[model samples]
Target chain A: MARINSAAQLEKVRKDIVLKKDPNKPCIAICGGIGCLGGREDLIRAFEKEIKKQKLEGKVDVRVTGCHGFCAQGPNIVIYPEEICYTKVKPEDAQQIISETVVGKTIVDRLVYIDPNTGEKAVHQSEIPFYKKQVRNILGMNPKIDPKSIDDYLAIGGYSSLAKALLEMKPQEVLEEVKKANLRGRGGGGFPAGLKWETARNAPAELKYVICNGHEGEPGAYMDRAIFQGNPHLIIEGLIIGGYAIGAKQGFIYTRHDMPRLRENIDIALEAAREHGFIGNDILGSGFDFDIEVHLDVGIFVSGEASALMRSIEGKAPEPRPKYTRTAVKGIWERPSNLNNVETWANVPQIIGKGADWYLGIGSEGSKGTKMISLSGNIVNSGVVEVPFGTSLKEIVYDIGGGIPNGKKLKAIHFGAAMGGSLPAELIDTPLDFDVMSKLGAAIGAGGLFVMDEDTSMVEMNRFFLEFLADESCGKCVPCREGIRQMLRILTRMSMGKGKEGDIEALEELCEVGSLASLCALGKTTSSPIYSSLRYFRNEYEASIEDKGCTV
Target chain B: MSDILLTIDGKEVRAKEGMTVLNAAQSSGIFIPTLCHHEKLEPYGGCRICTVEVESRGRTNYVASCLYPVEKNLVVRTRSEKIDKIRKVLIELLLAHAPDSPQLLEMAKEYGAKSVRFGKEPSFCVLCGLCVRYCAEVKKKNAIAFVDQGPKREINFIPEIASKECWNCKECFPLCPTSYLQAAYVLTQGLVGFKNS
Candidate 1:
């Protein structure tokens, strides 16, 4: 394979790859994401052996792709052209899936997703309620391509956005388009990405840096992992474009060390991208040079914080510095740096490929793009779901989520993992907007939504979140280290049926002090769970104190 | 470099452009209490003791004076009712961990923070990272550092370095607000001997 020297050469390669492939060809895309591969290696092997046994080489394509999002019903497989969706597939079912779905074009009744409320079996991918309501702009490619193959990405018009950005538009023009799109960082804070880039570009530094926050230390969130493992080139393309836009020659992807597959996929994608000239020196012959290095988190939650992440990258303990100056202005060895979330970076290519108005027309007034949420806990169909902003929480929990399992009533929904607060079931009408959620004392966070049923105790939930926050706090600040310790102590005693008169007031006072005096977001938002729990469920605390146990 | 004029507690003061609020206040004879902050070391901002309300560019926020750089026209309130309340809570929290530290106890007394609302454990180390920073920055030894995280976070001397290098130097011992580092030094020396034997 020759390196692409110019944008025309890259476009020619994409055209050549696309012309060789037939859209109507039969292709089996098996879900190879971490969630779906739970002892399902044999399932993939079965498909390979069965295809060879049937002598269907080149006639049928068996590709192992990333997570299909409906993780509760995985290992999942989708047959292209007809778009036959199969769920909860096993090794024995692989042969039948090939014969019945791929060759015969007959849909298997049991493998299709059956709507829990309607008892309707949805054969195609678009018919199911879970996939119907989602507007999967970024995640839509996961089922269509194999992560290990660069050609699969190119055939789908992958690096065309980078080529377009480098060849057609100036750096300032690209930044202006992103600003018009109103894309916010999906990694908790939702800061405007365009503003961050403009600051880094204008900062007085000869060498600037761009970092992708893939640490994703939030307990239940796997959206970053899915995107990183499934579509590594998308992130790579976005990073290269970002480096070009910010005048940065170097970039880094700081992900968690625990996920080995995600790291391997990203490495392969980077090598392939460099070989294709989408990365490395003289990208697309536009006189732009950029490269990316992948770094792993050091098993700490606060490392996801921007300042702390920069410190970690600098070989120091991952503790956040005081934000007297924004990190974009002075960061990463005192050079200008731009750090955006994995999802925020992934949205860049779409905003560039299609115009900003096309991207803006999809979402609500303020937030103008789809958000990929990792829905887990009490829901029936737990996986990742990408919905446009302004979609109600009730619709997410019911229409797309297939409602709570075991016919149990949902009591509350916990958003933003430990840092975010919980909203009672009655407030499910709240739009999934960043501002709206923050107004209700809850945060959309990094797209982790944990549903709780009737049997779940709010008091124990509060204790669980406090324990997580206390364990993850950097111990750098007083309000975080000492304050969280005292709050946990009081909550523990209260949970153990050891009631006291002044405990509630003490907890409230501690919340105010911790929120006000803490140094970083990790310490500041630690009180959110406690404050919201007390706000909505004060009766639970009162009952625990008066009755010496939980009331519900 | 040009100096910036700012108001600290309603008194006009002039400070260097890069000077922190704590440095400006101290140079101007206005007092703001702090722990885990040393003039020679980089500001850690871990202990929120010197937090003050600052109104800058139409927005008011409480920031640690040790790390917040001085700006022209900045309005800084070093002592106030709300500031005092937050400081008392911070002192009370610190008191629970380091009840025997004379410096902490004196600060608590000065701030009228009489009682430890969350109970006490009688610990001597307040996790101020003074000894850790001193070893890394001034001594340039890098012998002792923090390990673990959250409430379980603690400091320990690197066994190899402590045995090979730190035994000859006691520079960080007197820097601890409490006498905890002195005891740690004795214990570490004994452990080194045991390991060598």
Candidate 2:
């Protein structure tokens, strides 16, 4: 493989890869994402052995690709150009899949996704209701490309944005395009990404840095993991573009150490990007030098905070300092640095490749583009969903998520994690725009949407979040460390039917102090769950206090 | 360096550029309560006792005065009803942890924090991170660090370096408000004795 030297050479290579590939050929794309790979490593081996035994090795193109988003059905396989999707596929079923679907073009009835409401069996991937509603700009390529192979990415027009940005547009123009797109930080803050870039670009520092925050420590969130494992080149491309936009030559990807598959895939993708001349020195002959170093977090949740992340990168204990000076001005060894979450960085290419107006035409007024939601808990179809920003919660929970399992009534939807709050079942029609959700006291934080059913206890849920926050807090400031500890004690006692008179008032006081006085977002937003729960479900707390038992 | 003029508690103060609110307040003879702040060491905003309401550019924010840089035309209220209430609550919370510490007790009295509302655990260490910061910043030993997170967060000696470096170096012992460091050292040394036995 020759290194791509210029934008014209990259375009030539893309054309060659596209022209050489046969679209009409029988290709098997097995869902090798983390969700599908659970207890299904044998499926890949079975397909390999059967293909070899049947003398269909080269004739049938078998590739293991990333997630397909509809993870309720595991070990999913999609046969293309026909787009036939098979779900709940087993190792033994690979033989029939190869002989019947690949060779004979016969549809497998048992493996197709059956719609619960219509009693209809969907044959193709696009026909499924979960994928039907989603406008997957970034995740749409997950089913097409093998993550380890850069050729597949190039064939699918992966780094075309980098080429367009480097060859055609100047750095200021690229930054202006992103600014015009009105892209906010998807890492839960919703701060304008354009302004952040401008600050880092204009700061009086000879050396600047860009970081990708992939350490998604939220309990139910796995969208970052899916994007990193499934489509690593997209992230790498976005990071390189961000490095160029911010005038930084060095970048870092800070991810959690637990996801080994994501780590492996990212490692491969970075090395491939470097070898292909997208990462290291004089990228695409544009004279912009940028490279990324992958740093695994130290397993603390607060380490994902921007300042604390920089501190961890500097080889110190990950504690957040007061942000009198924004991290964009002075970060990472006192140099201007730009750090964005994985999803936020992934959205950059589309804004640059396609016009900013094109990207802004999708979502609501304030927020632009689509958001990747990690739908989990009691939902019928629990996985990742990429939806437009203004999509209502009812549409997501009922339509895309397949509603509650076992015909249970939707009790509450916990948006975000401990830092974000929950909304009652009555507010299901709330649109998922950042301002709209935050107006209702719940945030679209990092896209963690956890659904609860009728049998769930609101007090218990609040206590569970408090316990999580208590465990994940960095214990830096007094209000966070002591305030969270005191609130947890009161909530634990109330959950156990030992409620004092002023427990509610005490919890409110703690929330006030924690929100006002705590240093970092972790401590500042830790009281969100408690405050919103107490607002909506005061009866639950009252029941535990007065009746000495939970009503639910 | 340029001089930044600010008003703290309705008194005009002239501060140099990059000077913190606490330094500016102290330079102009204004008193502010603090627990984890040390002039000889870098500012650790863990205790949050010196939080003040500062209005700049028409936005009011409660910031830790020790770390927040003084800006020109910034209006700082060192003592207000809301500020006093938050400070009192913080002192009460600290009293629950270090009930016997003379420094914490004095602060509680000064802030008029009459009662310990939460159940007292009577711990000696307040989790102020002063010792941890001092060891890492001033001494450059990094022998001690905060482990775990949230409520279970506690200061512990790094096992790899603790045994080799911390026995004779008692530099952070005096910085701790309570005798928790001496007690922890004795207990760890007792564990070492048990290992030998």
Q: Pick the candidate with the highest TM-score.
A: 1
**Per-model TM-score of chain B:** 0.90, 0.90
Query: Tens digits of per-residue lDDT for model 1 on A1-552?
Result: 788987778889989998999988899899888555657789888998899988887888888888889888888889888888888888999788888888888988888888877889898889989999999998889998899989999999999899999999999999999988998999998889999999999998899999998889998999988987899999888888888888899999998887888888889998898888878888888989998888888888899999999999998878898777988889999999899989999999999999899999987788779999999989998999999999999999999998999989999998998888889999999888988888898889999999999997777787888899888998878899888888888878777766577788888888988888899988888998889999998888776674566676
Tens digit of lDDT per residue, candidate 2, span A1-552?
667889889989999988888889888898887655767689988999999988987888888888878788777889988989999899999889888888889998888889989999899878899889888888888998999999999988889999888878899998999999999999998999999999999999999999999999988988887887899999999999988888999999999888788898999999999899999888898888888999988888989999999999988878887778988999999999899999999999889889898998999999889999999999988988899999999999999999999978998999888888889999998988999989888888999999999898877887888888887888878899899888888888888877788899888888998899999989999999888888888888887784567687
Interface RMSD values, listed in order for every candidate:
0.8, 0.7
Every model's DockQ, to 2 decimals? Answer: 0.83, 0.83
| Candidate 2 deviant stretches above 4 angstroms | A35-38, A546-548, B135-145, B156-174, B179-197
TM-score of each: 0.97, 0.96
Worst 10 residues of 2 chain A by lDDT: A32-41
DockQ of 1: 0.83
